[model samples]
Target: MIIQGFYNIIDKTLALQFAAPDAMKDPFYVDAYNALNHFTGSQIVTEIPLKEMQSYINIATQYASQTYNLQWAFSVMMGMGAAMNFSMAYGRRNITKMKELSGNGFTSTILFSCITAFGVFCIVYPGWNAVFITSQMGSHYNVITEHLCWTYTIPLLAAAPLMFLSYFFMSMLRSEGKMLWVVLMIVSSLLVNCGAGIFFMHVCHLQLSGAMMGTVFAWLVQIIWGLIIVFGVKGSYLKFGWKDMLFLKWQNIVAFMKAGLPNFINNAALVITSFALTTLVVQLPNQSYNNGISILQELYSSITPWMTIVLSAGIGLTQGARSIIAYNYGAKKYNRIWQVLKRVSILIIIWFTLMLVVFICFGGLMMQAFAFPKEYVPQYRWWIVINFMTYPCCAFTYIALTLFQGINKSMLGTFTSSLRTFLVILPLIGIGYAVSMATGNPIYFFVFIGLNDLISSCIIVPILVHYWFKYRQKLVDLPDDFRSTSINEETFKDSLEHLSKTEVTAAKEQTTPPTKKQS
Candidate 1:
């Protein structure tokens, strides 16, 4: 859903930069290919709202050993920031503030991304098509065709502004729970894109460009749909014109940048940490290894899609919950944030736990499905089984980070993620390696991945406790311009008013003994 094979083409090329020429499909290439876009893919939008977490009873008692997770959960951080901030402003009835945040978030992301994409086309292309980064074994970038390079790069580059702009608009609808229309538009665009992209990739032989154009056109659909609704619908209070969207607002940009820069840093740090972690796997053969290490690399590549599904589903729950939390946080209902957090965390945990158990328990079935060697089953099983330990931890930490940002503790959110990747996770590998060496267990490497999450959770628990204590009774500062809208109240108020009032009154009347009817 993010980038197509055109973007992934770089993943393969990055390996060419690092790996020996003869080794095309070996572990180095495999790891490097997978990790390339991951390390350098520019996420960290920081336009977000967030969620608190739930009961922290012993994780061992909870999930025992199994786990689950998401791919671009953090990417949502950007949209969440904007959506939440907009919601907050709306809750306070500050249309100016809401529009300011939305305008800046949307404008900054689109303008900056498009500019950066073009710059990348200029800088990155010549290195591939003309100039080359040489190895001692000669240039690696030379292998790519100028035609193929231009095909994927151009459309993707051109698609940047549209993609990000669509995302910014979608975030508003997403936060407002504008599901049916948004979903309809999305489904339609996606169907068309799939059909068109297929035609381009196959019939037209446009390859990556077709795929990217399909994406660009899909965004066009969203752009049209979003504009109609944002302008046509009056209540959202998110209206903007060319001046609002295109014209630069230094103040809003400064505000967003101040709030959002940390997320960018956190994102970059996580990628760097992940790449460093992958390098450990790449370097493992040098340590004392066998075919097991290479097998691990292949295993990582094979199950990546499945892993992404697990991650996507787990975070998808949070995405739904994010709006509730964001709106509440904006309305100054802090306790509701806690309540929403608990409920969402439980749902996510249960869902991910089920996913992990099913995947692990059906390990052989999964391997068979992927047509992996039956002998690969044990390591594959071990990979999911061991890393599954982190599912709850990862979910908890992500929710916490998001919520922290939602409540405008953006710095804390950044720190939480940065610490998880750079500080907690990387350091634990030595122990994992030592255990693996001493006990001759290759699976311990994966164990450290989960262990890092668990330890990071431990590190962040106190932070949450402190924040809860400090901001528990916090309320949004309602000024003259601020008015509590039906939208804001409907979420928290109407649940009791619309759904529970009749039942509660009936229960009270029935339990009151009817006063004997004065008889």
Candidate 2:
């Protein structure tokens, strides 16, 4: 929270002081100012009171505050939870069995986490530069060219090592005896990040650049920590063998692609669709809509880092919960598994509901804190409220998808996400663009984004219902004693009673035969 707040303060201070002035006097700024002036037709700049401005800033700050704390905590908690779950699930198994498995739960979690951190920084760095340079140059033109040039490339390069080290820790977590070591590695990396971020990024005046540099430096520290664990740690389970590497199986790669490719496609398509919608919005006659989209994008970027936290924690618990339930079902403990699944499902729903409420209630004030140019505030507020309503639907999908993964029916999970991205989001964007352009109503764009999730829910709810019924039907078809058919208790008791009766008859016959011999 502190690190995030520090960056927020620097960004707000610099953008307002440097960018806003240059933007006002300069023609480019004049053009933007005029465009907004024409659309709003109110002298909003001076008309808005300081009290409102302060209120906006306070709300925006709180949103950033929640996002920063939630994201970091989420990342840490998810990493730890994933590590623990992977250990408990696969730890006791032989290496051969472990190698054959595809999920590599710990590895996937860590890699995505590292990628998320890197992406967050990469995505934020560009916008940060935009804020700074636009403040300095008084326009948004050169920033794009500079982004293509050289200023932002280092952060992208820095992200590579973070991803690699994440892979390594994930591997270590999967290895026979290194849970504690992996925990230490993560802790050490975080400490380095905290110290450097506070000193260099905050105190030393590097701003966003320093923030990126500090994160990269933390990865470097983590890489060293990984090497120490790989080389120095010694134990019976830690016999570092070259054999496994000599014959890396292709099946692992295939399995990962099967499970992950859909998700990748889902996100990539969403990004493309978002870009298209933004372009459409920018083309709108309303300056407020265009400017609103721009600022909202930045606020959205700020909130994205914490998605790792939400997904990580949600995915971890769901994976563990599903596995336990699925195993019991496989062992024919039908009643027990059914009871457990119901309880867990209820808890997950409650948790998701709470998150929805928080984001919806506090979203606007949060966007305001980013302190976008004064002219665009109205549109920004509307979009913030509209954009976050998708959270509940997203959370539900995430948990459901994890459950599908658990049951080895991951295809269904992939399909659900695919439908959400391509079918729901993209189409709604097209409709939004068409409606907004034809009618000259910018609110349609806002309405469309919100409607997409509702549509996604419509599709998803039925599928989930079908899944429940299909599984329920299978349960009803099971035989009464199918659960314990391995030992037939009734048949064994019947055999014992017959055997006793036969023995009594044989004894009576033996006594009669002895009397005839005597005669």
Candidate 3:
């Protein structure tokens, strides 16, 4: 996850470098381009002017990226259901149930991917066009609309299904304990994305279209690799065949929907909140200050993913542990869940604390590496400090939410995740925007952004503590047989074999014709 995070940062930096103004064509941007080239040392000729590129990239990609993210989140929810169901079935030594769930997951991915692709097309193309036209957003808005319609629409829609499938496959693979393979798949795809993007933009001079093309190509690679592993790999426990694809159970689909609800809410809320923030930033009274604030917000947004690498680590730990927790819970081994939670908590705290220190010490250097204006580095450094002040709080929230998810407590997980975005951050952003306007000071806006997680933590941590106690007591109250610490491998294998025979018998019965009625 850490390596993926660093790659993400590098990818973003490269995208900017490739979009930079051409020094020869625009002598005015020569100095700025030189500065950027000093950092990136790139020889690629870019046509987009620096003044226009930042806002263009930020706004144009915002809807496409977030829309895809929302879709990915939904697919993740489906994937989580598949993973948890498969893990639990494995715990019960029920081979039939495991195969059924895996099949249903694959079927769900196909249906959902098609729907999401269509939805994305509608939303980004016609839906946004209608919005721009009706709002009377003027000539600049028209340019943005044109860019979205012509440049981004096709590639984004094309990639949606491939990306969704790859993500679902990764989730299933993770459940099967193929974490190493999953990591390799992600790294390979990311490398392909960057390399392809560089080739298209530099060698072909296709610019934004080239970048989107790269994304499409990368997802294609990922889905193909995922297919080979899931279907062709020798040791994989979970495999989906054509028969599995043909059997779609409504109950299983509903279960996946229920399982994924919390994560979907979390992702959707984030997209909405981001849209809200962008709206607020663009509406500031002073155009100069507004532009500055926009740049700041963009920089902050770019830095946020890297800063949250620690949070990603926490999430990764939770993901890794979730299968164990789900499996143990299914197997009636309550004690093991607590053990996993304890170790994950300790590691998360240590990781977050260490990263916080690093970010505080070296944030300015990072800012410089991104080619942020030297004069603004001091201000940006302060933003980094303030923004990350609540890392520990965020870490705790993740632990709490993941625990809820692991145990299949979607409501509790949804509530916990929603509190930070809707109950805390959104309100703070609104109030901060109002205050900034009233006081003629933009600092208030950022201050509230920085403080949101800390404030939300006050509510979240207590809930987490309360649930921790409640669940722990519940675990303690389980029967002795249900609380066993060890599994009997022989008994487990016997049960699996028995279940497999039962499934075959059931299948034969379903396929056989009924006897003729007696005269």
Candidate 4:
């Protein structure tokens, strides 16, 4: 659904007739042509339409807009996919038990994810476009066209890299389990997020752009932190062995790719859908209409930081719970797992409900902070309200999916993830565009955003209920002996060392084959 939403942004650009480059903006048309052809001819226009000029313009415009967004979205999707693959790879079974780990790796992952989400949220909400337009240097200040180009560029620039780094850091921490190093990395990264924001806003006097700058800086901090921990620190588990240092483990890489491939494909598909939705919306008759939609979307984007904080913390804690559940399940301590799940589920439910209430109650005040154009306030008001309304359903979906992850039933988890966007979101978005066009009802547009989630949950909830019952028995089936003991730090170290030695000795003994020569 997120991807679908993104595509809809592109569609809106197309509908607004903003997708095609307005050659009139170019100081030197010839120069513009040459530069475009040289750098991005694949994306730039080549031939003029031969027939039905208006209709052709419309069709071509949508196509170009969709294509442009699709390309960028694909790149971002690939980066995210890479992160997922790397993370799953690093956490493969028997390398290091998630139940027994120390240091900053996981913390760094959480921080990076939260920071990235926060940065993006800051950029999206409180009106970056306004600052963008007003903050332009000298000559471009009065030019709407120039302002449009710059305003549009900021989102793609600010968002894409932050997303990449978030995934990268998280993946690395999960894979390397370099705890202490990751902690330092996260601290530096946080400083980067907080520091950059403060610096840009205060010293540079660049209000929103500062947020973007801070995000980039945070990424740099994380990378450096990771490097320092791996190379400079002694006795760190993250340190590369001689073999790992000298050679890439292609097999391991492939394993991760295989495991995470589904997520990658799904993300890619969703991004494509987002581009499509954007294109469709853009094809509407007026630029103001597209801008209006953009405002609402921006509002949606703004909520991401808080959402990220919630999600990162939620996922991290759930991961810990999941590890416990898996262990207890394996040991056949069925009752304890149930107790744990019950407690965790109740906490999640209560917390999720509280967030929904807070958002709904304070949504107006929250929307006020953005200080959008007065003219658009009426429409924006409903957008915010509807989003708040959908919170419960969305939360339920997320909770259910997370529960699936805990049970090691990742297939269902994947399905839940896919269904949110592909099954529920895309179709609703299409219907919204159709209804708005046919009835000319602007209010109907925002309705689908909430409606889709509500309907999707309606479909998923029953399945989740059935599975919860069927697997409820599996959660607490651990043996009585396993229940009496807690997993400890030394357990993994001793087991790993013992296993490694045993394998090595067995190999040596096999090679020695006593008295084979006599035979």
Candidate 5:
């Protein structure tokens, strides 16, 4: 996950580089200019002013990044189906069910990706002007639309299906306890993406379109690599075949959707919140803030992907722990679940603490690396400091969400996931927008956004505590025969093996019948 995050950072930096004065030399820009001229049937000037061209590229890149994020959120949503279902099936030792689930999950994801890609394509191509005309960047609408249509939207959407498949394969691999394989897939893809990106953007001068093409190629590589590991590799615990793919069932599809809905909502909420905040930022009434819109947007675009990198650590930990917790929960090893939770909590705390320290100490340098003016570094540093003030609360939310996912409490997970975004930060955004309007100062908006986690924690922490105690007591009260006394790794493995063997023997006996009854 961290490797993937660094890929995003590098990808964004590369895209931003084309916003320079010399960007007109890029083939992508020239092609877009020609295409727009042909479509509009007017000889638009080739020599657009350098600063104006830079602004167009900068804004286009920011919006393009947002579109990519939205696509990724949907991919994560679809991938969760395989992750949860396959892990649960593994816990129950139902190898057949796991294969069926994986096949059904992949099919459903592909169908959904096709629909989503088409929908987005319609919006970007024919509907771009109508959709964004009312946006806050009133005068720049035409430039934004043209850049997005030619460079980012068309190229990226073309590979949406492959991207979704990549994520689906990743989820299935993760559920099968193939973290090493997953890491390899991600690393290989990132290296190819970076290498391809440089070749396209610098050697071929494809600009942003080249970067999008590189992304598509990366997804394809990841999908092929994952397929090889799953099917070609020997000694894999799960078996998947063509029969599994052909035998689709409505029950299986519904189950996958049910299991994955919470994750979908969780990620979708982030994309929506980001969009809302960006819109609000553009609409701020302060003249000073309005004058600095370019800087503000650029800063936001730079900071968010890196912040996602920080948060992805916690998310990655939760994902790893959730698989173990889900398996144990299916095996009825309640004591082991608590033990895993405790260890995860400790690790999350350590990780977030180190991150907080890093953000505080080097926030200015981080902004400087993005080429921000020295005079503005102090303000950017404050943004990081205030935004991350409640960073510790994220640990609790992640643990709670993980616990909910592991135990199959999708509604609880959905609610908890939405709490920070919909219930807390969104309302705060509205209030902050109003406050900024009244005071003619946009700092209030940042402060309100920073308060999101802290305020949500007031609700999330209690719910998490209550459930922790409830589950702990439930474990203590379980019957002796059904409960395991020890929480060691060996005991857990032995219990699972014993149960699996017993189940196999029972199945054989049922199928064999009683031949001796004839005597």
Candidate 6:
């Protein structure tokens, strides 16, 4: 929190900024990019450590899940797809292949995220009521809902590109253990984000949109600085030509996606499911009897930013372990890999136990950071306690999920995530809605949120362990373009050439037989 002190200040200030008597609730919104952004595997390590970036995946992003439409949804799916591919390439230390992968991943994912944003933006001329505002709050927010959706997508457009490009460098620096440089990049971005945000709000008076402007400025700086440092390093940047991307390598893409795409799917599935679940939870048949769940839900959104502080701390450990695991996996150090897992597990147990205890004790104080209205105190407190009970379950599930991802068992990880999110958790939430409608109790609805975590932990932990044994010593699949791990510009170009080779040349190797000694 101290290292990320700026964001804590920003968020704590936001509670005051938005909650003011003359406060504008609509535009000066918290960062909403997270709804559309799912950083796969190592990007989690890069982006989540700083408080500002972590909150960039803020409560608004989560809350917006229920509000955004299919286009925004698919962008998340593909964005995670891109993130997964980048992390896997780095895990293999496929430096030669990274240029092409980075090019494709950045260009393709940003295009999708931005195009989807523009697609959403285009709807701003109206029709939001029928299309994007399908959430239960749709009726309540009226035109406001549609307007926020339009502006929200703009931030996703700005944020997704910044995050995607930076992840390439963040992944590389992290792999090489250049921790100092990574911190500098992140902190510098935070500073720019703050400076730009304040300037836009105070000087330019862009109001809520100024927040988006601030974010874009910060990320643009990070991207520029990152590229400079990267190209500045002599002999570091991989050599590439336009010819390299002319033809598609279906097999290589498939192979990378096979190991990588699951992380994307798992995350995307969770977001999509959460979006649906949010729609259901906000609209109980007896909603009027309960003092309006939307206000509570909106207020509840504030808690996640603070919760992110704790979650980020826990993830910090998992990410460090992930980097170590990925590097060792590439080196084929099985014993070392197992050791890392064991250490992470022990750490998780200790960390989660302490986290839950702290939350249980001081959780109310944490809520005070949000500066909720006095009347909402009871509702806020109830939500906090219910959320606190699930922290341990959440911690275990995350560590387990990250473990599968780190060693590149992303398919299993994806399977576990999809099952937990779609099949198990959402169904449980559905049941909660059923009970709430039957009993006219909104608390039942929120209790299910905690219950889903428990049920998911029960299911996910077992599946993860089963797969851990199943694939314990197995080798990871290599992309078809993988020639060697050696880092050289000429060899890198040759690697690209290998991708473009004729079918017969790639399929068959040539060699001259040694002359017989007898002859």
Separately for all candidates shown, the number of backbone clashes (residues 3 or more apart, or on different chains) is 17, 6, 0, 42, 0, 2
- Model 3: runs farther than 4 Å from truth? 3-11, 19-55, 62-64, 126-153, 285-293, 307-310, 368-371, 473-519
Off by over 4 Å in 2: 1-92, 99-141, 144-150, 167-188, 198-207, 220-240, 289-344, 373-379, 473-519
* Deviation from native of the Cα of residue 445 in model 4, angstroms: 2.0
Question: Whole-model Cα lDDT per candidate?
Answer: 0.53, 0.47, 0.66, 0.46, 0.72, 0.55
Report each candidate's C-alpha RMSD, comma-separated, in the order given. Answer: 16.1, 13.6, 8.5, 13.0, 6.9, 11.6
- Backbone-clash count (model 6): 2
Candidate 5 segments exceeding 4 Å error: 18-22, 26-56, 126-150, 287-293, 476-519
Rank the candidate models, highest lDDT first: 5, 3, 6, 1, 2, 4
Predicted candidate 6 versus true structure: per-residue lDDT over 1-519, tens digit per residue? 123324444623532343221123222321222222444554432221233322222333444433332443354344334444544555556765656654554455455556655655454334544343445354344333344434544554546556455544555455455567768877888888777777766676554455556656765776676666656755543323464345445654554455545545654565566566556655755443112125444445556556546655664566566667766666566667678878887877787678778766766666655544445565557666775576567666666766776777776667665665576777777787789888987777778767766777888777767867887666353333434664555877887877768655745644434469834
Stretch of 10 with least lDDT, candidate 6: 18-27
RMSD of candidate 3 to the truth, in angstroms, is 8.5
TM-score of each: 0.67, 0.59, 0.80, 0.57, 0.84, 0.72
| Ranking, TM-score, top scorer first | 5, 3, 6, 1, 2, 4
> Which of the numbered candidates is closest to the native, going by highest TM-score?
5
Which lDDT tens digits does candidate 3 get at residues 93-115? 66656777888788887788888
lDDT for predicted candidate 6 compared with the true structure? 0.55
Pick by TM-score: 3 or 5, better one? 5
Candidate 1 residue runs with Cα over 4 Å from true position: 1-78, 118-154, 207-214, 261-270, 286-295, 363-375, 429-442, 469-519
**In model 1, how large is the Cα lDDT of residue 137?**
8
Score candidate 2 by lDDT. Answer: 0.47
lDDT of 1 by residue, 331-361 (tens): 7676677887788777766766687677767
Q: In terms of TM-score, how similar is model 4 to the real structure?
A: 0.57
lDDT of 2 by residue, 1-519 (tens): 112223334433333333233223434334443454464545434332333223222222222322233234324333333333333234233333333232343344445556655544543355555332223222233322233222223453446445444544433343334546655665666666566655654466443344445555666776677656555765322223455434444554345445444445554554455445434544554544223233433444334333334444554455445545444434445455556656666766765567667656765554444444445555465565575566566655655554564444657866776666677777787887688878977667767777765677777778878877777645422333332222344566787899999999999988875566677
